[model samples]
Target: MYRNLQLLRSIRYSYSPPKASVLLDVSNCIQGLKQKLQELNELKVATARKIADYDPMPKLEVKMQEEGFVIKVLSQRSCQGLLVFILEAFEELGLDVLQARVSCADSFTLEALGNKISIS
Candidate 1:
């Protein structure tokens, strides 16, 4: 009885090493992350090039009010698609876009109203 019990205690669970599969999975995840980071870097470079074309530069002002918030952006006429950029940035910050108004002439003015959320 003692001999049989000793043999059962020394039994091999599996021939395959568990760490080998885990290491391979981690390596694949790392490769995927690297590809994603490369794409983001390329996007950053493209955005930088587009922004470099502005002449008078871009200005941003934010006013936090009791009701909500108001954001004002001033930029050269050459600067385009700033509204879309502003919307994206606001959404990223978990803000809700209430209304938007734009004025155009010698310079461009973008006024956006938004409400902030309590992120807890």
Candidate 2:
């Protein structure tokens, strides 16, 4: 009968496809994950470069004080590099760095000074 044909056609069209919004949500999720992966990759590369450039043996002069000690160093590297080195040195010495001061001249000279405080 004609009624039976119409009912079958309705059921067939009912299972036609998913909504466009669902597809858009899936696409957005994929793009977000791709962006996160790219950021992680960039972080990995930067960390690797820092590790490679690190110097394990830099000259350190320690001056004893009433509470703690002061550290000094002289190097022809960038101020940023010296700062990183000084922080790592404090970590190795099992001391806490209380404050850091850096001075430099525009004529290609860099000076890094750090004050350390003992936890004990």
Candidate 3:
């Protein structure tokens, strides 16, 4: 009788379901880590693309004035090169740009008379 009782107890213990709560918690943690890593990678790629899109030329802002035209050309290009290009373009169009003021930056802004000037 005692042997039967011991055998029944062993069988009950062996058949008990294993607790899975700890395993589930570990799986959730791993999944969260994976999601965080993916987000970081996306952020890195976006930052790289933004950096690559940077323009080295200065922003150009052109305007006109009464005494001929005031050409304010802001650019990262060397002053001589910028002046040469501007003068060449003006010459090509047969419009003389006078009194140029240049500023330097990452991009250029040129403000000059837009082919609508009356030169005496």
Candidate 4:
């Protein structure tokens, strides 16, 4: 009968929850941090993919004509003094603008037909 009581007591103790330890707590915290780091890495990769797929460079096309050259510039972004910078470049190149169209509302666009200026 005493042996039976000891067996029952042992069974009860075995069924009880284990005591928490510092090592276990640290291991759990490390696991949680690892999961959070994985999530952050995934988010970073997704953002980088979006940025890689986007192209912000401006588009420029120049066609040579019989009398002059046709220049077309387009961009999804705008910068202050961009038009003035381009006009300065044209002046430096000594090109006389024959016809031109410009739009800077939301995007920036410039279509120009120009020819080299004759020096007398």
How big is the positional error of residue 33 in model 3, measured in Å on the Cα after superposition? 0.5
**C-alpha TM-score for every candidate:** 0.47, 0.36, 0.40, 0.56
Clashes of 2: 0
- Report the number of the highest-TM-score candidate: 4
> Model 3 over residues 1-120: C-alpha lDDT tens digits?
545444544544433233344344445767999999999999999999987776566655455555555556555444547667777878876776544444546455566653444577
lDDT of each prediction vs. the true structure?
Answer: 0.75, 0.59, 0.60, 0.81
Query: Candidate 4, residues 1-120: lDDT per residue as tens digits?
Result: 545444544644433233333334445767999999999999999999988876688899999999999999998778789899989999999998899999998789999999999999
Candidate 3: count the clashes: 19
**Model 4 TM-score, all chains together:** 0.56
Order the candidate numbers by TM-score, best to worst.
4, 1, 3, 2
Candidate 4: which pairs clash? none
What candidate 3 gets wrong by more than 4 Å, as runs, is: 1-18, 57-108, 114-120
Q: How many clashes in each structure?
A: 0, 0, 19, 0
Off by over 4 Å in 1: 1-55, 104-106, 118-120
Q: List the residue pairs that clash in candidate 2.
A: none
Tell me the lDDT of model 2 at 112: 34
